[model samples]
Target: MGVSVFSLKGKLALITGGGTGIGLGIAKTMIEAGAKVVITGRRETVLQEAVDTLGKNAHYRVNDITEKETLPAMVEDIENSIGPIDILVNNAGTHHKATAQETSDKDFERILQTNVMSVFALTRECARYMLQRKKGSVIMIGSMAGLFGIDKIVAYGTSKTALTGLVNALVTEYSKSNVRVNAIAPGWITSNMFLNAIANDPQRKQQITNRIAMDHFGQTEDIGHAAVFLSSEAAKYITGVVLPVDGGATVNF
Candidate 1:
């Protein structure tokens, strides 16, 4: 109802896997909206570089979310040493490019551990703190792969599909309180990693673009912009919904 709806001033946002790609982009967008952002990853170097690029308000956490033994302690540490975690972006995930039949048990387990389990662990721990504050947001980065029967990425697709379920259940229980939860399903984004993959093969790129209604892939910033909105008051009424920022890919296809 006011200009402050989309403003994230004075908020603290933590983004996992935020040292690069879509995560980094979202961190930058939130900072621009006046939110203090912490971009985290397993690698110290990458996290540090991301912090540097994101300016002083940007911080880095080197803890691996998949390491269950450390997540609880790390969350507590950040809460006390850093600040109350007002927002959590469970963006850390792993992608496996393999056919359903060809994918190994280990591969499946690894994907689940990173993409799903880690999110569950971090959210559960962080929710305790948010419950006390009665104000926070949790954003799970999902994928368009879950929208349909995508090929050659069974593990990745399944995890994203599960994320929707997570959002729905969590929102139903938390909407009446301080914590709000939601998810974003992004389509083929033109990040450095993705652009290289698309550029390496001509037909694959064209086929993908042709299938999308916009005739193009989305930029990482597009997803970032979406994240900022969801974390801000602009999305106060929005929860438990999976917003697809897929460049009309879902509709056309």
Candidate 2:
């Protein structure tokens, strides 16, 4: 028997916005797959709770990603204190649900600041080390809104769409250095808040369901599994791809 290609044993992963939801899902799954994970968020309490839930292999850091000036030092500190960051998951983002006409320039710029600029800044910081060592994997958390048009989320869609281009451009530069970059476009992942929102709105639920070819929303672990694959040895040759983890939602009529 040989080593499992999918095994993340000895890997250290850094995930942003990991206090809850899909980020936490990815962290849990990665830990189960044998990686030590550090989760970052703006709230200390939330991060602490998430780490407690994640158990011994998990850690937490409270930092605002929008503070771009701190990212380089933050990355260095993490690497020195924990270990070299073998994987980076750009999972932190802000969503704006408003028509383009209703979304002000400030609203749009805020979305970009969190979703695009910060992501690139952090990725650049981590990639510098990865490129030097010639080993690393970077995963961007994208959305269905980025892949296609959706009403009332122009700003979010733009940010995510930017990630696609970022992944492409970064892969071109980093693949040669053995550092892989990719994006995961998740569609309608179920959460308590989302479930609650739809529970009282059957028509909206049905409309959403009808748009999905699978007629259902996805689970957070669905995204975690995809992240695991993309970060594992199994995907060594894969790069510059935005893999959709949607339940056929992106392709439905």
Error of 2 at 9 (Å): 0.3
- Write down the TM-score for model 2: 0.96
* All candidates: TM-score: 0.96, 0.96
lDDT of 1 at 49: 86
lDDT of 1 by residue, 1-253 (tens): 6777889898889899999999998998999998998778889999888888899899887888889889888888888888889899999888887789999999999999999988999999989889888888999999988777778889999999999888988987787776899899998997876676566679877778887898677888899999999899988778888889988988885
| Worst ten in a row by lDDT for model 1 | 192-201
Off by over 4 Å in 1: 196-200
Q: Which pairs of residues clash in candidate 1, taking residues 3 or more apart in a chain or in different chains?
A: 134-178
Rate residue 45 of model 2 by lDDT: 97
